[model samples]
Target: MAGRTLIFTGPPGSGKGTQAAHMRDRLGFVPLSSGDTLRAEIKAGSDIGKQAAQYVQAGTLVPDDIITGVMLAAVSRQPTSAGVILDGFPRTVGQAEALDDGLAAAGRKVDAVIDFRIDDGLIVERIVNRRICKNCGATYNIRFCPPKVANVCDRCGGELMQRVDDREDVIRTRLATYREQTTPLIEFYDRRGLLRSVDASREAPAVESDVVALIEALG
Candidate 1:
């Protein structure tokens, strides 16, 4: 059987990445995160990374070609029968089209697009209360998943600190950008009958179960 490809999308604090990671771990799928992939390339300072950095540093969208190239390369690395979970790509309708085109060239298509739904208010609250390990990058939430010791990582014994960008004003701005840019992408997938929304305000396990059931239904 051909691999199942799915896209997980949402605002910053909506747990889309967590759900995508769950699907990847439990189902043996590769999780390809556009942000993470691009960041890696940028850190490596490759030619393409430098090109991407120009756009990123300028606070503009990386040209669709560059982003699409990264996504295509990631897909090429995976086996034909290995499902792929896309996280944090296709932020705009144009990127969505680019993804479809790239996948078509590879003789694959997106099986489903899972949009995690949560309100902006809750997103702000969730993000502000969250902290990350300075050493190992493990994430914790003050309200949801506090560490064993206060303000420290349970796994790595690292200091946990809040990101500067996680402040309320920055989060609100990100939400505004999401509504402006990402909503159209959601509509694009909905038009193609590939969009399924999961209530992301629920706990992680519940959302993961909903996603698994949705993919199984697609089969």
Candidate 2:
């Protein structure tokens, strides 16, 4: 529970973001999501953002170096007291090494890496049924966590719609790529004794409880 950096990884639709939100609140740490940071930079038209915008527009993944630089910059700016909860960053082994180096330079290192293990069939179903609020980016699973009204966001009253990438084929490709690229990162953390595996097939509250327990056990 003390200030420490934590990285979370999982395939798309695995509820990593939901758990990250819980950890951020419970631990009082900044949740640093690489996707959110990159989007913000791209919106601001920063130098790196311009480069990232091209890949994003073309539906290509941003290069590892660009993502590493952006993430390191974000980590450097985090307040010392709160530390950080990293999500959707270090997708590759190279980026993981770069992140470690960045943290070393900052006089810190990764405290833990939590990987959410879930079945691909479940992921496909979850993505297909998922609805997101365009205004606040809040996600709800139609089958599991439907909004107050159909196609409506409970928090903001925003119109909810399925994301294009959440389609069947796209979800398959994303899960495949995640397995291909992120498996090594998982091993990398595991070797360092910082990896914690959680069953993501259960309910969100159960998964969050497991993660909290794991962190407490580590302490």
Candidate with maximal TM-score? 1
Name every residue pair that clashes in candidate 2: none
Flag regions of model 1 displaced more than 4 Å. Answer: 42-50, 53-61, 132-140, 145-161
Q: How many backbone clashes does candidate 2 have?
A: 0
Q: Quantify all predictions' global Cα lDDT against the true fold.
A: 0.88, 0.87
| RMSD vs true structure, all candidates | 2.9, 3.7
Please write out the lDDT profile of model 2 over residues 1-219, one tens digit for every residue: 336888989987899898998887886768889989898778988787788889999999789988887777777777655668889988988899988898888767899998999999999997899889989999998898899899989999999988898899999998998999998989989998999999999989999999989888866
Tell me the TM-score of model 2.
0.82
TM-score of each: 0.85, 0.82
